[model samples]
Target: MAPVKKHGRRRASVSASELAQMGVCERLVVFEHRYGKRRTVEQQQAIKRGRRAHARFYREGHMDWTRWWRYFIVFLIFGRWLTLCVAKWFQVRKPHHET
Candidate 1:
């Protein structure tokens, strides 16, 4: 016969420190059973605020990169065209055989 387990199921509880730890790693509270307590209104609000803050940060960072890329592309095209114009104005050409 299989040996019976002696330990009972553990109770689920969240302390203030656990709440803080949850902010760092949500999986920390994975042991909480389905019968455990639900999140409070304040926690829900904080989660919403965090999501908004992260979205704003992401948008602002990408906006800066998009603006920089536009300037870089414009510079590349205009610089190359200006360089060719200047060279042509100076009549830079090789012998016909070099073509």
Candidate 2:
């Protein structure tokens, strides 16, 4: 493997994926580096589908805090008011003789 030139110096570093590919078939890795990767039509379509699916999943999982923070603040206020109401109810329900 040739060392990659960086900052006027040769650096020898193998990425995890490169090492994995080397483990599988070092000759294939060499050939791929020399020429290029050639994928079938189905493989290309599958890659596109996978990219779209990942993008969809990312969008679905993302939270827009600008739109959601107001609701969260409202929920907190309502919870505090409910708690106070419940505490007052318990105080009112207690017998006068218990004091």
Candidate 3:
């Protein structure tokens, strides 16, 4: 495709932030350009935002403990709640104890 036609090339402006994100994963830049998709719940999970935030509470400096707790609490409540709901649904639908 490249020899005959200049296709599949990104026209991204590739700003500093874009470059930084691309460093993590080029797909991020591509998705951002195509969908303008900002940070999502899944993305937060992938990056372990909750754990990262919670770490600050125990680290050397005791700054921003409130924010840390918020992150930890939200993920514990929402994330664990979602897991429990899915597990219950699967348990009801899944086959088991059959002859």
Best by TM-score: 1
Return the top candidate by lDDT. 2
Better of 2 and 3 by lDDT: 2
Where model 1 places Cα greater than 4 Å from the true spot, the runs are 1-33, 92-99
lDDT of 2 by residue, 1-99 (tens): 343455656435765656788899988878876677777999889879988998987776665654588789999999999999999999889687976
Q: How well is each residue in 3-90 modelled by candidate 3, as lDDT tens digits?
A: 1225756554544555576688876657666667667889769658656776865673555677788899999999999999999998
| CA shift of 28, model 3, Å | 62
Among all windows of ten consecutive residues in candidate 3, which has the lowest summed lDDT?
1-10
Q: Following a full C-alpha superposition, what root-mean-square deviation does model 3 have from the true structure?
A: 20.4
Clashing pairs in 3: none
lDDT of 1 by residue, 1-99 (tens): 111235753436545656686787655455343235467999889878988998999999999999999999999999999999999977976667864
Off by over 4 Å in 3: 1-63, 95-99
- Give one clash count per candidate, in the order shown: 0, 0, 0
How much is the lDDT of residue 92 in candidate 3?
Answer: 89
Estimate candidate 2's alpha-carbon lDDT, on a 0 to 1 scale: 0.77
For candidate 1, report its TM-score.
0.56
